[model samples]
Target: MAEVSAEARIEAPAEKVWAQLTDFTAYGEWNATHTSFPNGGPDTLETGATFVENMKLMGFPAEVTWTVEELETTRVLAIRGKGPMGVNVGTRYALAADGAATTVRIDGEFTGAAVSLMAGKLKDSATAALNESLRKLAGLVT
Candidate 1:
């Protein structure tokens, strides 16, 4: 299994950051690994809702079918998915309000036979992607 995480502080309130984060239609604009949502983003932001996303990581393209596992307006969003080669992927976006600004953290995990073979490289790539994604997200709201 491979796990990666990144955190950043944005010069905007939690609500502002949450708005941009949940705006799935604009997801690829800032999410580094995102390619596109083939059938469009999820129609609802509730637990159990599912969506399909196309993404690129480690120079390879993949399609994932994701189910929302958790949701809390302006605070958290978590999803788990099945990716190519039977890889299981999980991601969580958490937000904390701090006065006039907000701190955001993204945590991701990968597990499956394929991951065991390239865990190190996957960790490095995923960590970088998360950081880049956070930077772009901050740019949009801050």
Candidate 2:
């Protein structure tokens, strides 16, 4: 398994950050790995809602079927998905409000047989993607 995380302090309120984070229509603007949502974004942003997302990582494209696992307004959102080659993917977005700023953290995990073959590279790529995503997200909200 591979685990990666990135955190950034955005100069905006949690609500503002959360709004941009959940705006799937604009996801590609900030999410580095995102390519498109083939069937549109999740119909609803609640637990058990499912969506199909197309993504590119390390020059390879993949489609993932994701199910929202948890949701906490303006605080946390977590999803688990099945990716190409039997890889299991999980991502969690956590927000902590601090006065006028919000600290956002993204945690991701990759598992299954495919991950074992290139765990190091996957971790590095994923970490970079998360960091870039956060930077773009901050640009939009702050």
Candidate 3:
């Protein structure tokens, strides 16, 4: 298993950040990592809400089937997914509010036969990608 985490402070309120982050249906509009996502959005951020997303990782096209594993409004959101290349992954988003600013933290893990072989590179790439995504998200919400 390999774990990676990244954090960023956005110049936006917690409500604004939460709205953007939970709106997974429109992820392709702001998130550069996702090329395509399912049209049907999750009913709510609760365990069992399901969806699929097509994204690019390490310059490779990947599609993942995901289900919400845990969620708490404006606080925590976690999703687990599986994909090709023997991938099992989970992503958690944690948010904290400081008056007008919001701090967003992303923690992700990948565990599988192939992941063990490329854990180091995958971790680095995932960190970079999360940072870039946060920057882009800040622009969209703020």
Clash count per candidate:
0, 0, 0
Give each model a TM-score: 0.99, 0.99, 0.92
**For candidate 2, what is the TM-score?**
0.99
Q: List the residue pairs that clash in candidate 2.
A: none
* 26-88: candidate 1 lDDT, tens digit per residue: 998899999999999999889999999999999999999999999999999999999999999
User: Per-residue lDDT for 65-123 in model 2, tens only?
Assistant: 99999999999999999999999999999999999999999999999999999999999
- The TM-score obtained by model 3 is 0.92
Cα RMSD of predicted structure 1: 0.5
Which candidate number has the best lDDT?
2
The ten-residue window of minimal lDDT in model 2 covers: 38-47
lDDT string, candidate 3, 1-142, tens digits: 8898889899999989999988877676666668887556676668899888888988889988899988889889999999897899899989999889999998999999999899899888888888888888899899
Report the C-alpha displacement of residue 44, candidate 1, in angstroms: 0.8
lDDT of 1 at 93: 97
Candidate 3 residue spans exceeding 4 A from truth: none
